[model samples]
Every structure is written in C-alpha cells, then in structure tokens.
Target: MQRKKIAVIGIGSFGKLFVQYLFEDGHEVIAIDKDPVIIDSIKDSVTIAVALDATDEHALISQGIADVDYAVIALADDFETSIICAESLKKCGVKNIYARYQTPLQMKVLELLGIKDLFNPEERAARSMAETFSFSGMRSSFLLSDDYSVVEVTVPKRYINKTIAEADLRHKYNINVITIKRPITNKESKRASDSKGEKILGIPHGNTLLREDDVVVLFGSQSDITRFLES
Candidate 1:
C-alpha cells in the first residue's frame, strides 16, 4: 500500500488506536492532541505527536497539516472544538477530511463543511477492537498473551530470496510463519510478474520462497517477534 500522510486530531482511546493502526499500515501519521500526557503516550508510534490546539489554523498550517493527504478529527466529548478544528482544517486547504460526532447537531455541523465521512462512537470490547485493526497486518492485534502476539510483518532483508525452509523462522525466531501475503503474479511457469493486487499464499510450506515485498503473518511471543523483525 502507498504511504499516506495523515493528521489525527484527538488522542483519546479511539483516536490513539486510529493513529497506531495508520502508523502500523506504514502511513506517515501526525498525532495531534492538546494534552501533553496523551501526546507523550503516542509520540513513539507516530511521525509527529504534538500537543497543540487543533482549532488554531496558524498552528495547523505551521505543522504542515494542510499538506497531508487526509485529516481525522475525533474530539469525543467536544463537538464545539471539533467544529472549530474542521474550519481550521478547511482554511489549511485539507480536502479529504473525516470526523466523529456525538449528537445529531454535531453530525450536521461536520456535514456542512463538506465532510460526509462521519462516524459515531461505538462501544467496543477490547479484544474485538484489536481484531478489527489486525487485518491490515493487525491494525488490530492478536494478543495471545501479555508476552505473545500474532503479528503480520514484512520479510526481513536477510530472509529475502531464501526459502522458508532455509530461513528457518520457526527454529531461529521461535515464530510460526502461518501465511504469506504476496503480490499477485501472472502465471509463466511460476514467473512472478507484478500485478496490481496481492493475495495470501495460504499455508506456506518449507519450500515457499520469501520476497522483498512479502508480508509474513507469524505467531510468537512479543520479544521473539521483536527480535525477528529487528534482526
């Protein structure tokens, strides 16, 4: 997927996950919130995490929010502030925008700004929420334990061009490569020419070869997965 620049205004529970999932998708995400503590919590996961008033147009412009491909405003309880932020985003020339609203009036205000993409806050369970985000390599996460997580990650450079049998992920990293998401290729005696889409190569066998662009869905402890990806 192409990397997009996105500005997310608000750092509450839902907004934090939105930023995390976007970042995990390999997008350049700018996380904006007024609370310093909230900003600090999310700083490591985003391209930029700033504690600033989103309603301030000058501040938004200075942060280059206008140049981002999209912006999401999700001030959970503050519909008025969200409204102001929408206007500020408009002034900054951000075209593609999405917002969350609590009430009917909040929806109407956002709709008036040409923001048709609005979502209502839904009550979600923890595990279900994680599962929802995990599909894009886990915008949601598959947390088997506090120590273990089933994660989808790109193939390490060292593993590229090697067969799964040779890489020995199971032995070396203690991680199971359950499947591989690879670019759809035309059949020419296994000639992998790029198509415009990707498909999951179900149940990779020992002979399955790894590619530079392959995203491997693996299951393991968090520490082991970290080691696998980092090394």
Candidate 2:
C-alpha cells in the first residue's frame, strides 16, 4: 500500500475510526482534538496525536498540516466547528479536504466553500436502510447520490443461466452489471473456511452467464434498480 500523509481534526467516534483506518492502511496519520483525554486515548494508534483547537489556522500551520496529502474534518453533530476547521485547513493550503456534516443544509454550506468530498454517515445509513426495507432482494445498497445507487442483489431465478446480452439490462431496466461474484467451493478446506466463499471475477463481458448463486453488482438510478430487482 502506498503511504499517505493524512491529518484528521476532531477526535470523535467517526474521527477515531478515520484515524484507525488510515493508520491500519500503513499511512501516516495526525490526530487532533481539543479534549486531552481523546487525544491521549488515540495517541499510540496514530503517528501523531495533538490536543489542539482545529479552528485555529496558526496552530494548524504550525503543525505542518499544509504538507499533508489529505485532511479530514470529522466534527460530529457540530456544523459550526466543522466550518471553522475546514476554513483553517483551507487557509493552511491543504489541497484535499473532506468534511463531515450533520444536515443537508450544512452540506450546502460546505459545497459553497469548495469542499468537494462530504460524508454524512447518518443520512447514508438511513437511506440504505430504507432501500433494504423497500426491496427484499437487495442484499446491500450504497447511495452514490440522491437518485443513484449501487446495489448487490441476488440473481432472480428467471434470469439464471441467461447471458448479459440476453437480459438487455441497460435498455429494459437502465442498469449495468459491474461485476459478478460467485461462491467457489474448496474441497481441500474445512467446514468453515474463510477463503471458501465468494470472490469477484473482475468486470464481466457481454456474454457472461448468470449462475443460480451468482451475486451481481448493479449500478443505476434508484427507480431503475427497483424496477430491475422487482422483476
């Protein structure tokens, strides 16, 4: 894995996870929070853990955040603090800034400030839950936008053994099959082997056949995905 210099502001639950993931990925992580307890808790887990006010631009610059490859503002349930942290990161010349906001209105404000990447965990979870409840065949779903989603669905019995071209998914349902994941049985393994499960077969070709146990990854608008799954 290529190592990256990442700075995370606000050592809340989400921020801690962000630091953990980056650090586990073999990247250099700098964790910042106002609370000494939070900073101390995550100190050993990251490259650097500092108890500092993220809203202070001078402090951010002094910490050499301007040289980081990416900076994330993970202030939870606090839009004002998020905005100040984002402003401080921008002033420090951090090129890539990812900010997490609580509401749609906060998203708009962040967008106006030229922050392209935004994360709203609560909203995403709610949307995914709604989709799961609405569609029984949907194993898992991810929202790309308000109208678009990527869903993993069980192949309907009617489409089993059918080729991709025969299904005409794009024309009939306005969805595209990104790839196919098929369970591969390992005779040499024990009853509960982790590697005895499904694995991606890369991008499928036009003539790729759909098997009975094949899990397909589909991408399209929400309505189209619903239509495809329901059929």
Query: What are the candidates' C-alpha RMSDs?
Result: 14.7, 2.5
- Candidate 1 lands at a TM-score of 0.55
Model 1: residues >4 Å from true position, as ranges? Answer: 123-231
Q: What would the TM-scores of all predictions be?
A: 0.55, 0.85
Specify the highest-lDDT model's number.
2
> Can you write out model 2's per-residue Cα lDDT over 131-220, one digit (the tens) per residue?
888876677899997789899887888889999999889899989999988888777676665547887989998899999888899999
What is the C-alpha lDDT profile of model 1 across 1-231, one tens digit per residue?
A: 999999999999999999999999999999999999999999999999999988889989989987999899978988889989988898889999889877788778788878887876562245537554543333234665557777766776777999999999899989898899886655544433443467899999999999988888888887887676556
For TM-score, the strongest prediction is 2
Indicate the worst ten consecutive residues by lDDT in candidate 1: 132-141
Query: What's the distance in Å from true for residue 72, model 2?
Result: 1.6
